[model samples]
Target: MKQDIHAIEVHNLTVSYDGKPVLWDIDFNLDSGQIIGIIGPNGSGKTTSLKAIMGLLKPASGFVKIFGKSLDEVRDRVAYVPQRESVDWDFPASVLDVVLMGRSKSQNLFRRANKTDIGIALQSIEKVGLTEFKNRQISQLSGGQQQRVFIARALAQQADLYLMDEPFVGVDAATESAILELLREMKSNGKTVLIIHHDLQTVSDYFDYLVLLNTRLIAKGTPPEVLTRENLSNAYGGQLTLLSKIVDLIRQNEFPVREKGFDL
Candidate 1:
């Protein structure tokens, strides 16, 4: 498929926490209407990259652009759905109340939530299969429900670019499949999704493009091209020796044992 027009551009992006570089000299282009994944081991700066791109954390140097303009200049065109654990789930709030927060950003900071906003919030909640539990307190919902609720809020914004931080963490297999399908639908509808995915086994099936990051860009390309031995070695800190050995061993086996009832 042809790449969509560029929607997000990062130039020499760098971020530091407590004066220690967490992300360094990162650069990439994200097109409109593509589902991309950011993957690496824990603490690989995946979330940090998303935060920096969304302007939640300022880059120590360099800058990010949205639609050829500075992030600050086009804030409305971008949206962020942070990890569920990032918020106080136990905080007093209903499903409807939480979804409404997405629209609140555009209203006067102190204005009371309005009827139109409430309608939009309810619509978003329904979109994520949470309508039946709209009145339930947020804490009462399961992990998957919470993730869907947040994704619904992002949909409400109708943003051109979305940065989701681990939207699948703690979700069940069914919910994971649901979320992936939703992302595919978003791409078809001309929206961009950049997700921080943890499951390497599912990476190729989930994303078209990937940024295999490890405190830096290990590789950035289509899934097959980027997930090769060389890129895996770099991203995994030169630990591909074991993976290579496994592949070689598997290839050399004369009659690979296909488990009973699982013939390949």
Candidate 2:
């Protein structure tokens, strides 16, 4: 069987801060048109991997390719939604203003938004269910609404691949569901989305593919294949409490048990 070109590929990616390694020899390939989740314990270099892929951070070594090409070759075909905390909510920009910025790269940054750009921004806002708040200042919106605004911005980019960092971190259940629905719609439309997610419980439900990492690539595959007890133990170390929860999830969902000789 022939293989499709991966939406994103990272090979031997090593990143470090001040000589202390954050990610070490990470490698993975993500297929197009799937919702993929990157999950790991805190400080496991999930966000660092995303930055490297986006070219925000220079890898200490190795390379990343998008659509089988260098990032610069397909930069316009990619979009990114950063962590909410990384943004300045008080920048005095309306939701529409922010979303319209998504088009800045395609358009001359100094030029005004054209009718087509505004139309696309409006549609993106509607897709995120934030049409009513489009004119509101981002600072005035709640956490979930703010997150939706960023998603709308990313949608406005109209990219083939999206990299999101912890989009569901502080949202309510309803907002989470709404975002997930929108993500599924994106996937159905053939857009590949990779999200840095921390919630292990929702991993199986939210992602068609999962990449479990801890300073290195632990495993990458369909959720059933990557969320094994041994893999979880390897990624999370001695976090027995988390392991207990994983065991319960495995029992309840009947996921394949791939390893033996250790109590789950």
Candidate 3:
């Protein structure tokens, strides 16, 4: 079998803040029409990896290739939905208004958003099942709705590849399902979507490929291959031991003052 000509490629992708590293040497190839997941604990560099690929934050010593070209060289062919927390939700913009920004890259800088752009924005909003709220202020929507809006914006970009960061952070089941369904549709249409995912329990069902990361790339392969116990342990830095303790406590309601009551 041959490796697909990757839609996105990263090699020796190390990014740091000051002298401290955020992303260590990471290498992966993302092929078109796949729903790939990036999963790791907080501070495990999942989001940082996505940002490096999007060219939002420059890698301290590595390169990112989009469609086999530099990020800038193939920017319009790639779309990014940054982590929702990265933006101010209070900004003055309606849902449709924000989605229109996706088309800006294709328009003359001095030109105003046109009727055709409005149609495309509306189409994207509809795809995300947010058509009725197109005129609603973005800040007015729930967390999930805001997330869907971002996905809609990416859809409006009509890019061949999409890089999304932690999209399911606070989304409701319906909205999460809706967003995922749309992504599947995009894949069926030959678009590649790389999402930063947090829920390990759902990883098997959610993505076709997995990029398990810590400060470095722990593993990369189909979920069943890369998400093994050893790789997951490496990604969690053995914190799974402590994390499991907390989860068991939560499930048992074993508060500091309470007896240990276990769940079946």
Best by lDDT: 2
TM-score of candidate 1 against the unseen true structure: 0.86
Per-residue lDDT over 80-139 for candidate 3, one digit per residue giving the tens place of the 0 to 100 score: 999898899999999999999988884368888889988999999999889899999999
Predicted structure 2, TM vs. truth: 0.88
**lDDT (0-100) at residue 155 of candidate 2?**
95
Error of 1 at 14 (Å): 1.1
RMSD of 2: 9.4
Query: Which runs in model 1 stand beyond 4 Å of their true positions?
Result: 1-5, 238-264
TM-score of model number 3: 0.87
lDDT of 2 by residue, 1-264 (tens): 114789998988877665555777788988899999999989889999999999999986789999999988898899999999998899989999999989878438678889999999999999999989889999999999999999999999999999999999899999999999999999999999999999999999999999998876889999999999999988887554564455456556655333234211
User: What is residue 176's positional error in candidate 2, in angstroms?
Assistant: 0.5
Score residue 147 of candidate 3 by CA lDDT. Answer: 92
lDDT of 3 at 132: 93
User: Number of backbone collisions per candidate, in order?
Assistant: 0, 0, 0
**How do the residues 1-264 of candidate 1 rate in per-residue lDDT, one tens digit apiece?**
346447878787877676555676788887777899999878778999999988889876778888888876777778789999999889899888778778756536898878987888888787788889998998998989989988988877767788899999999999899888888988898888899999999999999899888767778989998999888877776564454454345446632322345321
Query: Distance from true position, residue 31, model 3, in Å?
Result: 1.3
Question: All models: lDDT?
Answer: 0.81, 0.88, 0.83
